[model samples]
Target chain A: MLKVNDINVYYGNIHAIKGVSFEVNEGEIVTLIGANGAGKSTILKTISGLLRSTTGSIEFLGHNISNTPPHKIVSQSLAHVPEGRRIFLQMTVQENLEMGAFTQDGSKLRQDLDDVYKQFPRLNERQRQIAGTLSGGEQQMLAIGRALMSHPKLLMLDEPSMGLAPILVEQIFDIIKALRDNGTTILLVEQNAQMALSIADRAYVLETGKIILSGTGQDLIQSDEIRKAYLGG
Target chain B: MVFLSYLISGISLGSVYAMIALGYTMVYGIAKMLNFAHGDVIMVGGYVSLIAMTSWGLPVWAAVVVAMVACTVLGVVIEGLAYRPLRSAPSLAVLITAIGVSYFLQNSAQLIFSPNPKSYPVIINGSLSLFGGKLTISYISLVTFLVCVIIMIALTLFTSRSKMGKAMRAVSEDKGAAQLMGINVNRTISMTFAIGSALAAVAGVFLCSSYTTLMPTTGSMPGIKAFTAAVFGGIGSIPGAFLGGLLLGIIEAMAKAYISTNISNAIVFAVLIVVLLVRPAGLLGKYVPEKV
Candidate 1:
């Protein structure tokens, strides 16, 4: 489980995340849904150790990782797939996945590679192809597959469906659900509220750097305020 | 026959420059720093190997090893002390700091070794007869070319096949994402510096041995040329550095022989400008669009 308590993040003079707090329980899919600049990605970045929190703390499985470097935090079994699918463009698909397993010894590396390939068959087909040449959807799959290579305890995905087609988005959501069912905890950040809330066990609605609503996914999806604000009802 | 001889000698000189250029390209690719002090590392390597041979009475092979080790350590120390702290600083600031380091190395060498040039003992002696002894290639030139080729092949294999190599490529692509993958970015950068500096040391030994002279500023001319070669080959591309160094050396040799010795440097830069104008990304470099 991951616990975030009152973390504030800033970009020089601008306050980006204001006292945002959330928790992701084990074996569940938790989602943060909001419009642009809602501090969802900032929260994830802070937890992943890419950015520091000016106030409060983040605890991953009872360990305080607020001050840890990003690489060290990853060794603790937390994987973050940043927004924009930051896969190594020049490297081959297999190489990118290998990079994802950077913390692991060669022992389970082959098994891990097989597991990732099984999840994304397209990646297996293009294992030797350069990542930048892949389609947007494939790149997203590659990003997810790369993150899964680390065998993370908790996986954080930022805007995995941002540029994806509706059909591909559904497929990605199904994959997320399957991953949770298979015992991986997921913290998803999304702009697609309807799709996110449909799969997430619990959901938080963020607006302008603050969490405005929190409830079970179904409740939020059915709530009049969320429906009007995010569901386009 | 004369032209062929000049071409052979050019290749030998180019091999040395290519070795130094590889160091520049690799460091620039991963660390995003020009490492102006890199040339100075070559100078230091020359000094280290000279002292090891003359003062410490070490064999040529042992001296080369000592030079390599010394340069590697110095590189790591330079990264730790000078470049690491400026990781987040602007590129201009890092560039200035690198210049400062370069000057420091050169000045330190001058203070220690004095400004006068010293004779460098021959490490590789003898020559190979070509076309019935009418044309002969020195053993050192052939050895330098052979060593450069071997190192290039080895480096290519290491970067493509190793886990650390994957981490390095990842870091170069995206530092934040690379960390998310659990790569120690700082450690990768340090390793890059170490490898690059060690290569520079190899080049330094070969250069000093061939020229038979050593000076504190000896590394500057080749350093600038190798830097130019890196840029000409497409700054971050490995093969680009190799081709660039070789081509630059060949061009310089041809110009000195045919065009006039005094204007060879000018002609090298002129070729760089023309090639860059034609292909902004350098010979083997790909144009990468900046990500938002």
Candidate 2:
């Protein structure tokens, strides 16, 4: 489980995340849904140690990782797939996955690679191909697969479906659900409210760097205010 | 026969340049900074080796090891003290700092060793006759060329096949994402500097051996020339650096031999300018568009 308490983040003069607090329980898919600049990605970045919180703490599985460096945080078994699919473009697919397992011992690396390949068969097919040449959807899959290579305790995805087609988005969501069913905790951030709500166990609505509402996914989906404001009803 | 001799010597010189250029390219690739102090590291290596041989009475092999170890430590110290703090600073600031480090090394060498040039001991003596003595190849030239080739091949394999190598490539691509993958970016960078500086030391020994002279400023000319080679071959590409160094060396040799020795440096610069005009990314470099 991950616990984030009253975290404030800033980008120089601009206050990006204001007193945001949330929690992700074990064995559940928690999602943060908001429009552009809603501080969803900022919250994730803060938890992943890319950006420091001005106040409060982030506890991952009971360990305070608030001041830990980004690389050290990854060793704690938390994997973050950043907003953009920042895969190593010049490296081959297999090499990118190997990089993902940077903290693991050599003995587990082969098994982890096999597991990732099983999840994303396309990656297996293009193991030797350069990542830059991958299609957008394939790149997203590669990003997810790369994150999974670390055998993370909690997997955080930012905009995994941002640039994909609707069909591919559905496939990705299905994969996320499959990952959850297989015992991985996921904290997903997305602008796609409908798709996110359909799969999320619990969801938080964010607006202007604050959490405006929190409820079970089904309750938010059926709420008139949520439907009108976010669901395009 | 004269042409043959010139070609052989040209290749030998090219091999030396190629070794130094690899150092530049590898450091630039990982750290995204031009280590102007790299050339000065080579100068230090030559001094250390000389002292280890003459003053310490060490054997040739032990002296070479001493030079390499000294350069490697100096490189790591330089990174830790000078470059690490400026990781987040502007490129211009870092560039100026690197130049400062270069000047510091050169001045320090001058203070310690004095400004006079010193002769390096001959490690490889004698020559091999080829084509009935029409083409004579020095033992040092053969050794230099063989060593350069072996190092290049080993480096290529290490980068492609090793886990640390994968981490390095990842860090170069995206520092943030590489961290997300659990790679210690700082450590990878330190390794890169160590390897690069060690290579420079090797090149320095071979260079001093061939030229038979050592001074505080000896590394500057070769350093600048090797840098030109790196840019000409595509700044971050490994094979590109080797090709660039070899090409520059051959061109310089040909110009000095056939045309005029006085204008050889000018000719090398001309080739770099022409190559840049024709292919801005160099021969093996791919053009990367700036992302918004």
Which candidate wins on lDDT?
A: 1
Question: Candidate 2 chain B TM?
Answer: 0.98
Tens-place lDDT digits, model 2, residues A104-196: 888988899999998899999999999999999999999999999888889999999998999999999999999999999999999999999
Off by over 4 Å in 2: none
Q: What TM-score would each prediction reach against the true structure?
A: 0.98, 0.98
Residue clash pairs of candidate 2: none
Per-candidate Cα lDDT values, in order, are 0.93, 0.92
Model 1 segments more than 4 A misplaced: none
Report DockQ per prediction, comma-separated: 0.90, 0.92
lDDT of 1 at A232: 99
Question: Chain A of candidate 1 scores what in TM-score?
Answer: 0.98
Writing each residue's lDDT as its tens digit, candidate 2 over B178-287 gives: 98898888999999999999998899899999998999998988999999999999998888888898898899999999999999999999999999999999878889
